[model samples]
Target: MLSTEDLALLEAIRETGSLSRAVAHLGKAPSTVSYAARQLEERFDALLFDRRRYRLQLTPAGELLVNEAARLMQDVARLTQRVRQVANGWESRLWIVTDELLEFETLIPVIDEFDALQSGVPLRITQEVLIGVWEALREGRADLVIGATNEPPAIANLRWMQLGEMQWVFAVSPRHPLAKAKGPITRAMVAQHRAIVVADSSRVTEGSTYGVAGGQTVLAVPSMRAKILAQCNALGVGWLPRHRVGLATRLVEGTDRFI
Candidate 1:
């Protein structure tokens, strides 16, 4: 129930060493500070200050209130700033969907910078694969999309910027037949092996996949990690991000398809 003025009185008295000095520091009359302090103490039925002390001294209850008041003031300040930012037309919240193929570690640094700005906009992030990234924006589930691949589906008012081209490496387990093939593997040869693919996360669109050869059998998984596991286990063969699976003889180079 103590007001900011009462808390400021405690703080000023603590810092300035006496009631008269606190009044001078606060630019208030000595009587005003004294009367407010007395009213606060009477309301709480606790002595806030040891008035007999030569210098300003707080009773245990006064110290507790001061400590708590400091924290409360910080919360109040942050809330006030957020309210002002919202009133100034800043976004209250933003949602983003990133493609599973994008390296999440690279995004962390940007997120750290955004947090430092304290823009009063809450950011929520989620992962989608391929076309699902675009669908999230179209469906109004997200305000931003990162690492969208292919020409985004023809939706009106969709604006995009290319972050950079993502390179995919065709890979398979050491045991897979493609790993043993010496010459350039054609689309027909690739079709003979089962392709491991991460399923798109779209709810509204039909969703899409890339790099799978015509008529290739597929082992669909939920995430990029799952696709890697399937290839390592010889469950399927498909392209994966080069950084994730690493360079190996089982991985074919020069198959860099830009996405």
Candidate 2:
């Protein structure tokens, strides 16, 4: 049976790409590391490393073992963390709903920090738009909601906090007629073209829309990012979050003139 140390040794060699480097990382002498690897290989009577090039390359059998070991180690880690969490009386799961306007990438560091705590609280994240966030909380679909824009309805036992304001700007592609139209754009001018809008993800609520003037052709998208891309491509025109406009500008700078 392979031990955790043996699996760790395989992982180190895979990461460093050299036994000498891997040994330094493991804080073991080169000879000792080599002896351990050889013993492991001999137990199965199969070559673990190619040993042809100067670099540490895994053989077919070695590759298989290392890959399987990685999954096994992940399972072991999660199991250990879950046990520790149960002892500490932590929750089994946490459901979170975030507004579509907020960038999900910003939550990466927060998720990493949470994982480090070994809280064993499995996180389930879902995206919502406008009133969908409130619907999620009201219907018990989510335990917490982030980036809720509107005031919650008069309901008992509801809690909320302000998370700052989100700025929006009406944008158009330079190739679009509105971009070249003289003076400020009016509702009539906007009505002549298609408006890009993200569909609200609320199931219970009827959902909401903004900046779509009366009689304007609507092109509904799944996410805020998609709406921005549609506008950049001149597929439709609509308001986009201020910060996302910069990225959209860069994306279409060379190929298309995005205003």
Candidate 3:
């Protein structure tokens, strides 16, 4: 493999058109440049220069190496610039995909604060369910997603680290008697009252216990928002992801409320 100094020496020779000038430009003795060039010529089994006492001149092969060396130097310059730019935060777009419910609380504020300090670090948020969110990141479409993953699908390319667990809860429309029920509302009791089940997944959009059915009557909807909206519209009781709860849900007061 050609070393960086070898390429530099080749480029210096082309620029100055003299071995002595190239060595002087490097602040090194001319013999060092001559020796390095000797090594390069021996490695390639070719003459690098048509040497004359007055000044150095390029042979045909030397001319080719000089031109190619110039191209290589340009590439090295661009690579150095790119590295410096990254170190200075020149490319700072952060792509995020998360359950839409994040707008209400923690994640939103964190993002807001990040934007305040690092306005240059732009963040773009998109809505995606757990697996789809992970898929987006895997497909190079997103940087990360904040949501629970369980029995996660087997994908060789996917990678994730569980940050922490979230609290879980069940909710019903305030109009439901379960909201006012005094003591343990037994599973049988809950079954008796028609709970507004959320068919919209966006309502049930927290990152926990997904795909685990809780309600006796279940309705499947597309997003967490839609699921919660269906509940607002007097749909069946929603087995909501606790964090996904909106302002109005009445937390069912009892154990065995969730499965």
Candidate 4:
């Protein structure tokens, strides 16, 4: 429970190594510094100065106190700064939920930029699919949501902006029948094959799916990446983000759409 003044007095005495020099360094009278030094030792019930030494050095106990107290002061300063930041509208901890359709790797640069700010707010990033992204924000499970898909639903105090649109391509494994389909793949034709889909993570709300026709057989997977893998392995066919399709899968022509 040492006060800042006590810490400063100890530091000055240690640094200067003489009562007269410590008083000069502290801009205090010699008698005042001497009396304060004696009070500090009495309060702690430990000899803090090596007065027997001609140079007036600090005892080991005094050195330990100064070093530990300086470290504690630094911790207090950091805690104070974080408290003020929270008071100024920064969240003490941030939980960000992104749609599983959005690759987590794409947000690395933005995360690095946030780290550079040294805001001291802890960040938690998670992923949800389809309606689950919106549900996370609505249910108070998330503080921020990134790359959420579909029209945003009504939620109290919700705020958002369009990051950008994603283009979708109907993709399938090269060995799949659709890869060699003769003409434009109609909704009827798509319905004939099992559609791979990432299941919505929503618990409270009725979740939704996209691009699947009525009565179509579905292979519900855990994430968009799994859906892509299922399609690439000829497990099923479905629309996928164009950027994620790559050469491993063939894109069904004439079905490009933006969302």
Which candidate gets the maximum lDDT versus the true structure? 2
Instruction: Rank the candidate models, highest TM-score first.
Output: 1, 4, 2, 3
- The predicted structure with the larger TM-score, 2 or 3, is 2
Write the residue-wise lDDT of candidate 3 on 1-259 in tens digits: 6778988999889989988889988888878888999999999899979986578999999999889988998778767766666798665467877754444356777877775863355568786665565556666777767763444456566677776665656666666567788988677766654444322222324433343345555555666666666665556554666665644443232222221
Reference-based TM-score of each model: 0.76, 0.65, 0.45, 0.72
User: Candidate 4, residues 143-231: lDDT per residue as tens digits?
Assistant: 99998886798898888898899999888787799889998989899899999988988887668888899999999999776787678
> How many residue pairs of model 4 clash at the backbone?
0
Residue range 95-203, candidate 2, lDDT tens digits? 9999988888888998999989767688999888888888888888888888877898765698888978878999999878899999988889999999999998879
Mind giving the per-residue lDDT tens digits that candidate 1 earns over 152-201?
Answer: 88778888877777667888887788878999988888899898999988
Q: Candidate 4 local accuracy as lDDT?
A: 0.83
How far in Å is the alpha carbon of 103 misplaced in model 4?
Answer: 1.9
- After superposition on all CA atoms, what RMSD does each candidate show versus the true structure? 5.0, 8.1, 13.0, 5.9
Regions of model 2 farther than 4 Å from truth: 1-89, 255-259
Measured with C-alpha atoms, the lDDT of residue 249 in candidate 4 is 42
